[model samples]
Structure formats: C-alpha cells, structure tokens
Target: MTILTVNTKAFRPLGVGMRQMIALLGALLGVMLISPGALAGGEVRVTVQGADGAGVEHAAIVLRGPEDAWEPPSDNEATIDQIDREFVPPAISIPVNTRVLFPNQDDIRHHVYSFSSAKSFELPLYKGMPARPIRFPQPGIVTIGCNIHDWMIAHIYVVDAAIHGLTDAEGVWAAADVPAGRYRVEVWHHGLDEERQTTGEIRVEPGTEVDLEVSVEVASRPAPRRRGTVPGYR
Candidate 1:
C-alpha cells in the first residue's frame, strides 16, 4: 500500500485568498449601505394661507432639487369622473407625461375639452368613458371643461417634481423622505393671484424637519352656471 502525503502549506495560499475575497465583499457591502442613495432623507411641511389668514385648500406644493426627478406612478393614469354635473376632485396635480381618464358617471353625456397650451384635447360627446386617455406632457395648468355642461369645470396641474403635496382642509401639505438639499419650492392655487404663485428656495437637511408658511392673495371667481338650474345659464 502506498501512502500519499498531503502538503498543508500548498493549501495555505488558497485559504488566505478566500479570506481576502470575503473581506473585500464585506467592505463593498458596507460602502453600499452608507452610500448617498441609502442615506436618510428629510421632511418638509408647508402651510398655505390667504391674505386673510384663512387656510388655503387644494393648493399644490412642488419641490425641485438638483437631484429631483419626476417619476410617474406605475399605472401612469388618473381618472376625473363627472358626477352630479361636476367634476369629481375639482383640482388635481400630476407629474408630466401622465394619462388622464375622463369617465362620465352621470346619466348625461359630456364633452370634455381643454384648450390649454400644455395639452389641448377634446373628447367630443363622451359618455361612460373615453376610448383613449388624454396625455399631459407639458408642465403647466390645464383647465378642463365640459361643453355640454357649462358648470363642469376642473383644473389639472402638471408639475415637474416627483415630490409634491396638496394642501388639505387645514391648508397643510407635507412631503416625507425628500432628499436633503436645496430645493426650489413652488406653491400654486387656482384662486391665488398671479403674483403670489411663485415661492422661493428651501434648504432641507437630513433627519430634520422644515416648516414653511406662505401667504397669497386669493381671488374669487364666479362658478360656472348650470344649465336649466339658473335662468339664462351659459
């Protein structure tokens, strides 16, 4: 019987090499865990009010930073239904390149149209639902109306910011997990005067909270008159 002698020294380098590879992988994972993309973000709470100090509801608050990127929802679609001769959710905000569906839930048909330069489209006498949705590619305000029902009116605000919030009944809006940086904050409301539409810069720090107060000149616009309900409704 011949006995084979195993050389332990020959396997030493192989074991060392395996240990080194494991260390390298651990270091890489540590770096990845501490990378900027993995860092904790901040939060911003904005409160909007009219000159009279009344809370402004349905106000759009958008934030734009150097790292800001607008990513539409996975569905990339939103719906504005017509019920009770009015557009549900009279105001809405969506990122650019969003497709909006107009579903008429009312018994009557509606002619939805928007002449806004951002997205000019018309659904001629649509009932139930339109065959195709309207795509808003530009960042601007698109006023939607129904030709058949003069009182049916709504506004869609196309914004470039992926991080945005709409003021609630308390006139407060909050954006959480926002990347820490200097951001251009914009507060917009349909009733706000043109001069008050613009807001300035805001600095957000990691793990910190920011509060902002904005006041705007609010104007009263007459609501669209309903057909048959009022005398000489247009």
Candidate 2:
C-alpha cells in the first residue's frame, strides 16, 4: 500500500483551505503511483515516419507484453509550457494518472481548457502557474486549447503500456531496458487520419539491437505566411 503524508505545518501558515489541501494530496499520490516498477528488460528502439518518409516528431509510443503483463508509470509529474502564444512541445506522452503543470511564460493571459472525455478541465485566464497541478486519472488523448487564442492547441497522450515515450525530432524513440521477449508496439499522433496505429509483436533478444519502423498517416498542417501572422496568434 502507498501512504501519502503531507506536512500540515507547511500549509498551515499559508492559509490554504481544505479543497486546496485535497488537491495537493492528490498530486502527491500521483507522484507515488508512478515510481519505477520491477522490470528486468532489455533495450528497444522505435522509429516513426510519416507517409512521405519524414521524421514524425511528438509521436506517442507504447510497448507492451502480454495482456496480463503491465508496468507502473515512469514519471510522477510533467510540465506543458505556454510560450509565444503556443503550447511548447505541441504534444506529450505520459503514463496514466500523471499530474501536469502548465506555466504561462507569455506576458498575456490565457484560458486553457480541455473537453476531452479522458480529462476535462479549464484553467481560467492566468499569467503564471495555477494553484495546483491538473491530475489525469484516465488513459486517453486529452486535447488542450486556449479559449483566447484559437490557434493555441496541444495534445496529451496517456498510455497504459509497460513502457511509454514520445518520438524525438528524428522520429525515433529509444526505450531502454525492457524484458527480452515478444512485445506489441503502438504509436499515436495528434494529426493521425485515424485514432492510432500499431505494429505486430516484436521479439526482443538479449544483448541485441531491435529496430522497428512505423508509418502513420498524419494530416498536413499548413504553414503561416509569416511568424505571428495567424489571425488569433500574437
């Protein structure tokens, strides 16, 4: 069992109320739930490419074993930064039940909200960090948008795989130290023509490199005539 202890004395002086205290405790629990798990696995690399054979950045990767096999989340908390009226990193992949923090670095305020079924939340217009982080208790895609700026958008991928990560600018995701066995891989992109795509079972051998490539059909995004020229872009 996981025990969450809060320093009541820490918040006592701040005049933080009961509701805020509960949110703080929930965030603490999210951290505990994602502690590293027991997995004596080998290394695995995944390469994600678009239809045109271009590196697909920010693609969510999921590798799993049998149906009964599973692993705990890899990290406790993550940040989705807001800069230049855009969501930095555009998209991110996190383990289920991860708490995310959004800090507005821009001078102007933004009202961030998401109506996705997995996690629905609205952070009223603000300029700095919110009172508490938003906790995602379910596994699914959460679409984030700014009410003030229609162009401001982002996606969060919450997965239940044994191990999960996002592809780099090179369309590559390297998963280190996974058990040497057959595992299924799944890839997701916010621009995908479909919800997501997957690869067949890949056999991982001890002391060997396993390379796999995935092709996804992502909708094309038109480029702006010039920077900060979008209708609602600042």
Candidate 3:
C-alpha cells in the first residue's frame, strides 16, 4: 500500500477562516437572543364588581393593544346547545368571523333566531343539528332567542381583540401571554343597563402581571321566568 503524508501549513489559513466564521455566527445569534420581540410576555388579572361591591360573574374583559394582530385558532368552532328549554352557557365570547353551532339537545324542535344588527339570521324549527353553522362576521353583541320559546335566550359577544376573558364566580378573570404594551381594556356585563360598558387604559411590562379592578352598574328588571313541565310554558 502507498502512504500519503499530510501537510500542516496548508491547513493553517483554512483553520483561521473557520474560526472567524464561527465567531460571526455566534455574534448574530446573540443579537437575536436579545431582540425586543423575543422577550417574554405578561399577564392581566381583572376583577369585576357591581355598584354594591359584589363580584359579577360571566362578565367579559377584553384587551386591545398594539400587538393585537393575533388571530383565532384556524379550527375554532363553538357550540351552543339548547337543553331543558334554555341555552347552555347563557353568555359566550368569541372572536369575529367565528362559526357557532346551535345544536338542539332537547327532545322538542326549537327555532333559533337573532335580530342583532351585527348578525341577523333564523334557523327554522326541526333540528338535531343545523345543516351548517352560523358565522358571526361582525364585531358586536348578538342576542339569540327561540321564537317558540321566548324564555330561551343567550348572548354572544363578538370581539375584534385577540385577548379576552370571562369572569368566574369570584369575579376574577386573567388573560396571560399578552405582549408588553399599552392596552385599552373594556368590561361588559349583561345585567348592566343600556350602554353598559366600561373602558380603561393600562401599560404592561415584560414578564409582569397587572391587576385591574372595575365597577359597573346593575339594571333593575324582572328575572326571566323558568320553564314549566308543559311546552311553551314558563
């Protein structure tokens, strides 16, 4: 066999070039790691209450900020089922352009209709599942009701903002992973009187948690009647 001898001096320049390239790549990676957009996000904790200082449940808290370009899940689909002559989850919050399914889980057929300016549609009676889902393209409140059963009612709050949360029984709602920036916060509840909404501004920093407290007025109205054993009877 023939033996080949390696030359050391010939590889000196190549070794120097490789070291320089690695250093340059490392510097670029460092810059990317410290970039502003690469920073961690923050969270917002909201507490909603009524004029009487009682926690308000099912209230919506929406956040609008500079980095609100986020979009809803591509497969986002929500269902509002009718059971026991009432709409399950009386209140729902969804992003604009969301498809909502109205499934009738009750034994009797019911007609679902909404006359809100944002969205107006009617699903004729006789259904387990409609042929297609109802798409809410506009951003506003859409009140749903059954023509036959007036007592069956529900509210859908369509929002353009990417971040929103609903208050729990303790009137606490938290939205996390929000980019740090100035944001406009809006609070809405069904019990409030006409034009029942509150707005405020807040600033969030990187990896920080902000707390907010909001007070709203409650409207005085007769409670909705419960469904009786007979159909169309409340």
Candidate 4:
C-alpha cells in the first residue's frame, strides 16, 4: 500500500528515463487488479517472442490472483550490484516488502535513483553499500538508474502475487509450486511502446505445468549505455 514519488529536476531530463518507468508501472498495475480465479497448486511456463520468432529477454511476468488468495508479502532480501559501470542482472522480480541491497562493486562512486511511483528514492554518490537496504512496499515496476552513469539502468518488479519472474535467454519464464489457480497474466517489455500487453487466462493446477507463449512487435533495442573514467580513478 506504499508508493513513493520523487522529483528529478536536479538530475537528468524528465523526457527519457521516466517514460520507461511510467510505462512499466502502468503495465503492472493495470493487469494485477483483474478479477482472479479459484485458488489451488501448480506450475506455469511462459515464453515471449517477437513475431519473427526471436526470443525476448528481460520481459517481466506476474500471475494475478484474488486478494483472498494472496499470501503474506515475502521478507527475503535481494541484491543488485554495480560492476563494470553497469547494473548487474539489469532486471529482477521480488515480492512486495522485500528488501534490496545495491552494493557498489566498481572502484568509483555512483549515484542511484528511481522516479517510479511504486518506489522512489535516491542514493547519493557513494563507493560502498548503503547503510540500509531499500524496501519495495508496493506492486509495480521500478526503474532505477545512476545519476553519474546515464547508461547504467536496472529494473525491479515488485509484485504482490505469489508467482513472478523475468524471461530468460530463450524467452522463457517459469514458476513452480505456487497456488494453483486461474490467473490473468501481465507481461511487459522495455522494447515495446508505452502501451503494455496482456495475454492469457492461464490456470495452474497441482502437479502440472502450464505453458504459455506470447508475441509482440517491438522496436530494436537501443544502444548500450556508456562507460568511462570519472574524475580520479585508475
């Protein structure tokens, strides 16, 4: 039930980074509220691809069930590191209320911030771990980036539902032993426009695996973020 809003006037322009953040937030929220089905146990295997048959990576998936069927938010802690001036892993899925640590593995300091409505905060330039981890208290997409490194970006998919994950190298995402029930699946990718996509009335049953395939037409991926020496590092 917690959402954070931040001002970005002191940092980068509002036109670019916020576009993806807002798009993702809308995607997660729009589908998560759909009416859920009977709760029960099972597995779901999903595949995302382009119409041309290429696997889509970094796509997020969430299975939305009724509030009555919702489990307590998870307390597990996760970590995303800064290495080679990049956000390692780039994207991740975590249950609502999960604490996440962002440790600087690189030699120089970097500033981290997010303007997403789901969870917004800023970590000023620092070279090591912050004194405390950031907790995601709501269900939505949180896009975080470095003020010192414009090209450095990452995503945190904070979900209230029990099952969620990002697609892999082969455009595949899966979850097992979750409450077996009928759910509407929400899918989103950065490559797509602001309009998010939803596909499936998928049902997960005990001792069974449900496989889903979804396709979307998207623009080509943007150029990789830049990397270089700051002021005083060897």
Candidate 5:
C-alpha cells in the first residue's frame, strides 16, 4: 500500500476564501482513506424544519459513509448564476475543487464576495456575465453576498461525501441508491442561527426508505422590510 502525506501546517489564512479550500483538502484526505467497492446498496430521505415547525427549503444534506461503504464522486467544478438581481436557488452543494460560474443575466452590475471559510472571492462590479468563473477548491460553507446590494446573498456548501442533495420548496430531499451500511450525516441551512448538527448510524437495505427529521433554530427575520438593493437575484 502506498502512503500519501499532507502538510496542512504549511498553509496559512488568507482571509475567508481559505475556508472552502481547506475543507476541500480535509475531504480529499477522507476520500483517500476510503475504499469504494466495499459497500452495499440502499436509500435515504431527509427533511428539515424551522423553529416554528415549518419546512425549510434549499438546505444542504450531506452523507459520509464508511471507508468501505460507497464510492464518492470525484471533486467537480460548479457554478452559480446571478440574474435579475437574485442568486439562483439561494443555496447549493458541490464537491471539493469544483469551479463555480457566476453568470449575470440582468442588465445591472453585481459585486460578489464571500466571507465564509470554505472559500472567498470577489467578482467585482460586472454585468451581463463575468469574464471568468470563480473556482472553489476547498470544502465548507461559502456565504456569497453582493457588495452593491446588501439584501442579496447566497450560500455554497463544499463537501466530501458520496451522496448529497438540496431540499426543494417543500423541504424534502433524498439521496437514493446509497450503498447499505453505516454513515455520518450532516445538514446545514442559512436560516440556522446556531450550528445545528446530529450524528447517528443507520443501516439501509435495497429499496428500503429511511426517514430523517432535523430541527434548526434560526434568528427571526423581521417582516421583509424593503431594504437596500434586493440582493438575491436567483
């Protein structure tokens, strides 16, 4: 067996952008130690709710199986579009090292920046489309904002897991065809005020449905006060 050694100690902080990059490195290390062919097949369903007992949409659900559970997807480059002054989907999930496209479909210009650890970048004042896409080389939560518009914000989650999905408007999501075995699951949301997390081991067999419910307490939002430039384009 070949051994790969990584020196994370050599890396230093260059602001929040490093968060995504660092997360990517951590996830890659996890992947290297995992053997993909050792897992059995199964399915999983996930749901998220607000403190008021309402459904939360577009939240991220990540599943990390055992080293022998399943094969994880290779890190990919991803994209996020800004159209009509809004960030699309409002939230997204991607594998480490994915490149994200920031396309502007609106007539106005936008300034994109992230203060989050997973990754941070700036698409300084641009319109129509950007000259190039931003690349996320790390794994973590990236909260994107429009410098020109305070109300506009979006989140990108970089993870190193075999199965992941975003909740729809109904706050429902599923990661199907998961190999049967034990796994570590995680869920994240913008509305979650504090870090909400739960850890459990579950066994899934072919065609069996596993139901999971997660709770998150988010800071209350004041009734949509028509604020500065409405940020979330799409």
Candidate 6:
C-alpha cells in the first residue's frame, strides 16, 4: 500500500513537469510568431554587374525588406578625401541621416559643394581633417565637386538599408545574413545611364545561393585630368 501511495505522488510531479514543458514550448512558439526574423536560418549570395557586358565596381547594391518585415540597416555616409587634387574612389555609399567625414588629405584647401535633392553642405577651404562632418539626411545622389578644382568631382548616393554593399575591384559582391523571403534588390552604378533603373525580384531561402546580373547604361564622363592644368589654359 505504501509503495502505491509513493507511485501516485511521483506521477503527480511528472504530470506537472510535462505540463510546464508544454507551456514553455508554447511561449517559444509565440515568440517565433511575433518575430519571424529571429527564427530565420538561411544564407544568400548575390553578384552584381554593369553594362557593356563588363563588371561594374564600387556600386551600391540595396536590398529592400518586405512590407511588415524586419528593419534593415540605413546608415548612408562616407568620407570624401581631397588628395593630390583628386577625389579618391570618386564614389561612395551612405545610409540616410548619416554624417560623412570630409578630411582634406592634400596640401591645399578644397571648396566642396553639391547641388542635389539630398542634403547639401560645403566645407570651406581647409587643409587636413575638417572640424565637422557633413551630414546627409536625404536619400538621393549628391554630386560633389571642388570649386577650387573644377576637375575634382565625386558622388555620394544616400540610401536606406542594412543589406547594401560596394562591388570590389572585380565588380563582384556577396551579402550574408539575408533572411529567407522575397526581396527587391537594386543595383546602382555611376556608369549606368538608364533613367529607368533595373530591379530584380528574388526569393531567398536559407542555405541557398542566388546569382544576379544587372546592366545599366553608362554615362559619358570626361576623362580625369592626369596633372593639374596650367593657369589661363583651356
């Protein structure tokens, strides 16, 4: 009789423990429902190209998240250096509401100016790093040029997304930690001349790889002056 009583007590505890386990699992399920990205387990790779059947390098690739989806990174801001009277790289990407550092690495001063829909601010002639950074709060392409040096020009495309990248020298890029779902990918290159841009609808699944190729019309830009032109000369 005592053994039977003990067994009953042990069974009671076991049943209670099982109920607790179920409750815990339910809580976890609820969390997963509330935040799908938390449970997303997958990877994706993307490759970008330019027009003329040639690879485009240093271009910005932005991935827009689906509606009612997780938030993406939106920090658009980069530095524009004036070195040897030339703009380094000549192009950069920045997220919205970002501050771009403009440090004059040259021996002379530079008057930077941009006329774009996005935020525009000019840095007076100064040598070395500036006292303040320029903040680009809008999402648009800003053309930067030096008043002192008309030959010096650069571009900054302010964007909004965490899933963005710059093409390497080989015109190739790979984005990781991208959730498994539908996304709209945009590729922008300075060389692309098309007014209407190209976009791709991609369904990214976990542990799967997706390859993309984009062709954009290249704008005709004057060849960069190798050496500073002599004063009073065309």
Per-model clash counts, in order, read: 0, 4, 0, 2, 32, 12
lDDT of each: 0.73, 0.72, 0.74, 0.72, 0.65, 0.63
Total clashes in model 1, counting residue pairs 3 or more apart in sequence or in different chains: 0
Model 2 vs. true fold: TM: 0.75
Give the local distance difference test score of model 3: 0.74
- For lDDT, the strongest prediction is 3
C-alpha displacement of 13 in model 3, angstroms? Answer: 51
* Candidate 5 structure lDDT: 0.65
Q: Regarding TM-score, does 1 or 6 come out ahead?
A: 1
Whole-model lDDT, model 6? 0.63
State the lDDT of candidate 2 residue by residue for 1-234, as single tens digits: 011111111212233354356556768877432223322344677777776667778888887777535654546798999998789868888887788999999998999999988899999999989778898878878899998888788899988775788898788898765766877777777676544565667776544456777677752232423336666455
* Worst lDDT 10-window in candidate 4: 1-10
RMSD of each: 17.6, 15.8, 17.4, 16.8, 15.6, 15.9
Model 1 poorest ten-residue lDDT run: 1-10
- Model 5, residue 16: displacement in angstroms? 48
lDDT of 5 at 157: 78
**Residue range 95-139, candidate 6, lDDT tens digits:** 777777878898778888887667667788888888888887666
Stronger candidate by lDDT (3 vs 6): 3
In candidate 4, what are the lDDT values of residues 79-194, reduced to their tens digit? 99999889988999888899999999988999999998889999999988988899999877889999878778898888777767889877789776667667877776656564
Tens digits of per-residue lDDT, candidate 1, 1-234, equal: 011111111223464466566666768876432343432566788877765677777778888886666566545778898987789888899988889999989877789999977889999996798899888988877889988766777988888778776788777898766787888778877664441254667777756667777776663233445657655554
Clash pairs for candidate 2: 41-177, 41-178, 41-179, 42-178
In candidate 4, how many clashes are counted? 2
lDDT tens digits by residue: candidate 5, 136-225: 767677899888777777888776665777888666787756776666667777655533254455566644557777666642232442
lDDT of 4 at 156: 89
Model 5, position 231: C-alpha lDDT score: 52
Q: Give the Cα-based TM-score of candidate 3 against the true structure.
A: 0.75
Give candidate 1 misplaced runs (Cα > 4 Å): 1-39, 69-75, 193-196, 220-230
